[model samples]
Target: MEFATFILAAQRGYHQSSESVIRNSIEQAVASEQAGFNTAWFAEHHFNNYSLIPSPLMMVAHCAGLTSTIRLGTAVCVLPLY
Candidate 1:
C-alpha cells in the first residue's frame, strides 16, 4: 500500500494570515514525509483567498530540501492561467 498527502494551503478566513497558511503547508509536507508518506502533493490556485498556493512546483522546490525520500508533486496545474 502507498500513502500520500495533499496540501490544500487553504485559508478559512482572515484570521489566518497568508504567511501562516503557506508556512503551515510547508510544515505539513515535512511532517508527511516524516510520517512515511510516499508523496506530498500541492494544489495550485491564484487570485483568491480560498487557496494561496500560486505554483506547486515552487512549493515542491522549497520542500525538496526539507524531505529526502518522499516524492513531491502538484495535484493539478491550470496551464491556461500560467
Candidate 2:
C-alpha cells in the first residue's frame, strides 16, 4: 500500500510562532520523504489557526527542493478565498 502524510501546520496555542509552524511543516515533508512515504499532503486555510498555510501550492513549491521523490499535494484549496 502507498503511504502518505497530511501536514496540517496547526498551531495549537499562541506559544508557537507562525514561522516555526511553517518550518516544522516543511520539515515533516522532508522527513516523510526520507521515511519512504509516497506523498505529503498540505492543508490550506486563512485568517485562522486551523491551518497556517494560506496556499498549499506555495507550500508544495517550497518543499519541492527539499524533497527528492515523495509527491506533494494540497488536501483542499478554497478557491473562493483567493
Candidate 3:
C-alpha cells in the first residue's frame, strides 16, 4: 500500500505568517518522505481562509529539491477560479 499526505498549508494561529505556514508545509513534506510516504499533495485555494497554498505546482517545485524519490502532486485545481 502507498500512503500520501495532503498539505493544506493553513495558518493555524492569528500570529502565524503565510511564510511560516508555507515553510512548515515544506518541512512536513520532507518529513513525510523520510517517513516512507509515497507522495505528498498540496491543495490550492484563492481569496479564502481555507488554505494558504495558491499554487500546488509552486509547492511541488519547492519540495522537489528537498525530497529524493517521493512523488509530489496536487489534490485539485479549479482553473475557472483562477
Candidate 4:
C-alpha cells in the first residue's frame, strides 16, 4: 500500500503567514518522502481562507527538484475555473 499525505498550506493561527505555510508544506512533503511516504498530494483552491495552493501543477513543478521518489498529485481542480 502507498502512504500519502494531503498537503494544504493552512492558516490555522493569526501568526501563520501564507508564505510560511506554503514553504512549510513543501518541506513537509520532502520530509514525507524521506520518511517513506509514497505520495504527496496538494489541495487546489481559489479562495484565501481554506488553502494557499491555487495550482497543484505549480506546486508539483516547484517541488520536483526537492523530492526524488514521492509522487505529487492534486486532490481536486476544475479546469475552467482558472
Q: Which candidate is the best by lDDT?
A: 2
For model 1, the superposed segments whose C-alpha errors exceed 4 Å read: none
For TM-score, the strongest prediction is 2
**Residue 68, model 2, lDDT:** 86
- Candidate 4 lDDT score relative to the true structure: 0.86
Clashing pairs in 1: none
List the global CA lDDT of all models: 0.93, 0.94, 0.90, 0.86
> Candidates ranked by lDDT, best first?
2, 1, 3, 4
Runs of candidate 3 with Cα error greater than 4 angstroms are: none
lDDT of 4 by residue, 1-82 (tens): 8899998878788688888988998999999999999998898887665788888888988998899899988877668976
Q: State the lDDT of candidate 3 residue by residue for 1-82, as single tens digits.
A: 9999999998778698888888999999999999999999999988865799988888899899999989999897878865
- As a whole number from 0 to 100, the lDDT of residue 28 in candidate 3 is 98
TM-score of 4: 0.90
TM-score per candidate, in order? 0.94, 0.95, 0.91, 0.90
> Candidate 2 on 1-82: residue-level lDDT in tens?
9999999999999999999999999999999999999999998878999899989999999999888899999998998877
In model 1, where is the ten-residue run with the lowest total lDDT?
42-51
Go through the candidates in order and give the C-alpha RMSD of each one to the true structure: 0.9, 0.9, 1.3, 1.2
| Clashing residue pairs found in predicted model 4 | none
Q: For candidate 1, lDDT tens digit of each residue in 27-54?
A: 9999998899999899998899878999
The runs of at least 3 residues in candidate 4 whose Cα sits more than 4 Å from the true structure, single-residue gaps closed, are none
